[model samples]
Structure formats: C-alpha cells, structure tokens
Target: MLPNKSDSRRRLNATGLSTGDYNKVNTDTTETDGFVNEQWVAPNVEEPIPWKTIAIILVLFVGGTICICCATLDWLADVNQDRSDRIGALTIIGALTIIPGGYYLYILLCILMHRTGYTMDDIRRLG
Candidate 1:
C-alpha cells in the first residue's frame, strides 16, 4: 500500500521518524498502521529559541553602532582637527567592524528563516 504524503510529513514533524519505520515496528500487530494507537504517537517536544543567534544579533547591532561612531569621529577629526592618525586608525577599525556586522546580520537572517521552515537547501535554491 502507498503511504499518505501529508500524514508522513506530519509524522516526521512530530517525531522525526518516517512512517515506513513506524510501520515496520508494528507489522506483527493487528493494526495496519499505528494511526489509531495512542502509544505509537510520541509527545512533541518544544523547540528551544535560538538564544545565541539572538545574542549575536544584539552584539552586531552594538558593533555597527560603534563603527558608525568611529566613522563620525574620524570625519570630525579630518574636518576640524586635521589629524591623520585618528582618521586612519578609526577608518580601518570602522571598516573591519562593518564587514563582521554584515556577516552577523546575514547569520541572524538565516536563523530566523530556518525557524520558519526554510532549510539551507531551500535558502540556497532561492539564491
């Protein structure tokens, strides 16, 4: 007999086990499938929030803010103080900070997307 696609997907979502494997275990029983058996259905566990990704997002926001401040300071130094040291140093630091901030933002976006059921393959396919 053919397996039902929606039911299989729902079972996978619940226990991460395929319907074929579930059927194999109950072959000797009177049941054709364990759909009617309460024991066969496992309780769903709550998925934990991605706290590290969230923390990284906050850190990236702060780093981006600092980078902007540094760029502003460099600009002020260049315009008023006419100092090359502050401008060069702050410019390099700001540029470095911006690269990582952008990367972190991308990671946060990926994390959020995955929570919404978009797998890495799905994300890559979209790109």
Candidate 2:
C-alpha cells in the first residue's frame, strides 16, 4: 500500500524530526560532564536534482528548436508571400521537424545505454 503524507509526517515526528513543518535549527550540542558530544548527527533527507544537469537538458532542447526555427523563418516568410507555396512549405515543415526528432532520438539513445546492462566489461570488449 502507498503511504500517505500524514503517515510519513508521523514517522518523522516519532524520530524527533518534522517534515514540511517550520522549525528552528537545534544547534545546542548534547553535553555530558562539561564534555561535548561528537557522535550525534541529524538524519539526511533525499538529495535534489542538481541544477547543472537540469540547465544542460533544458538548454539543449530549447536551443535545438530555436536553431531550427531561426534557420527556417526566412524560407517560411517567402512561402507565406507566394501563391504556389506547397513545396516550399512542405520543405520548411520537414526541416523544422528534424530538430525535435533529433533531440528525442538522443534522449532515446541515453535511455537505451542506461538499460542495456552493459557492464564496464562489455564496454571494454566493444572498444
């Protein structure tokens, strides 16, 4: 069964930690006989995605489309002004589609590479 949000919160509170609740940092070091305790540590929360990876992927996708559109705009503008514009429009459409298609294909390749169970030994053998 899937756990609900409140159940998780209760579990955290039981452990002396609260989730999604505002609380102040307890930096007061546990002490004994005027000696500082060094063993106590706060539990770790899940790490979030790094901003660099997100920026890279976002830039790649957006830059690819911007490149394709900028390249085709001139041809598209000409096509819009012409009476017999079927061939020109079709060519521009095909050019625009290639950018997104290539981006998706690269994403597919990354997924496939991750899933093939290609151990380091396998990669070394291929090389």
Candidate 3:
C-alpha cells in the first residue's frame, strides 16, 4: 500500500523540514548574520627579525672560515698522507658550510640594507 502525500509531509515536518522547503532559495538580501559579505584582510603586523637564523649563519660563516684557514695552514706544513687527507676533508666541509652560509648572509645583508625586493621572509621560507 502507498503512503499518503499528506502523511509523508507531516512526518518530514516533524523532523523540522518539509520536502518542498529544500528547493526554496533564500531571496532575502537585507539580513546580516554577522559574517555575510565579509572580506578577509591580512593583518598589518610586522614580522620580527629572525635573530636566531642570522646567528646560525654567522656561526657557520665564521666556523667555515676558520676551518678553511686552518686546513690551508695545515696543508702547507704537512707531508704525511693522513694529514693531507684530513686537510682535504676539512676543506670540503668548509666549502659546504661557506657556500650556503655566505649566500644567505648576503641575502640577509641585502634585507638589512633595505634593498628592493629582498626580504627576510625569503630566508624563513627556505627552511
């Protein structure tokens, strides 16, 4: 047996929605429910300078400089295979550290100097 349309509508209305109500569009434009037509705006707060990152780069640059200098001095005085190998390894490590450290240090200096298009945010994004 088929259920009556009125009975079905009454059951749906009891659940707080009628069948035809789902198809109806809200035509009212004047109501503001606190969030209507809201646009997002970025906050105007300034980011703090990244002191830790700068410090780390400075450490790497200084450490790499020391490593390369010591390695060069050691190479000039050394004749043994073990010392030469150690000097070569130190030079490699120094180069690895100095390359990125120097690049980022240059970027940071540019940012500090307020060069156009240079930003600390770029360094932050690299990590």
Q: Which candidate number has the best TM-score? A: 3
Decreasing TM-score order of the candidates: 3, 1, 2
Write the residue-wise lDDT of candidate 3 on 1-127 in tens digits. Answer: 5322222211124445644552322335343234322234456789876678888888888888989998999988886655887899999999998888898889988988999999777786332
Give the per-residue Cα lDDT of candidate 2 at 107. Answer: 54
lDDT digits (tens) for residues 7-90 of candidate 1 = 331222356665555322333434343354444556766655556655655675577668668768767756666776666676
Tens digits of lDDT, candidate 2, 54-119:
445455456656555654675556655563354455446655655554554465456448867442
After TM-score superposition, what is the CA distance of residue 2 in candidate 3 from its true location, in Å? 61
lDDT of 2 at 66: 59
Candidate 3 collision pairs:
none
The residue ranges of model 2 lying beyond 4 angstroms of the native Cα positions read 1-45, 78-127
The lDDT of each candidate is 0.55, 0.46, 0.71
- Could you arrange the candidates by lDDT from highest to lowest? 3, 1, 2
Off by over 4 Å in 1: 1-47, 80-82, 110-127
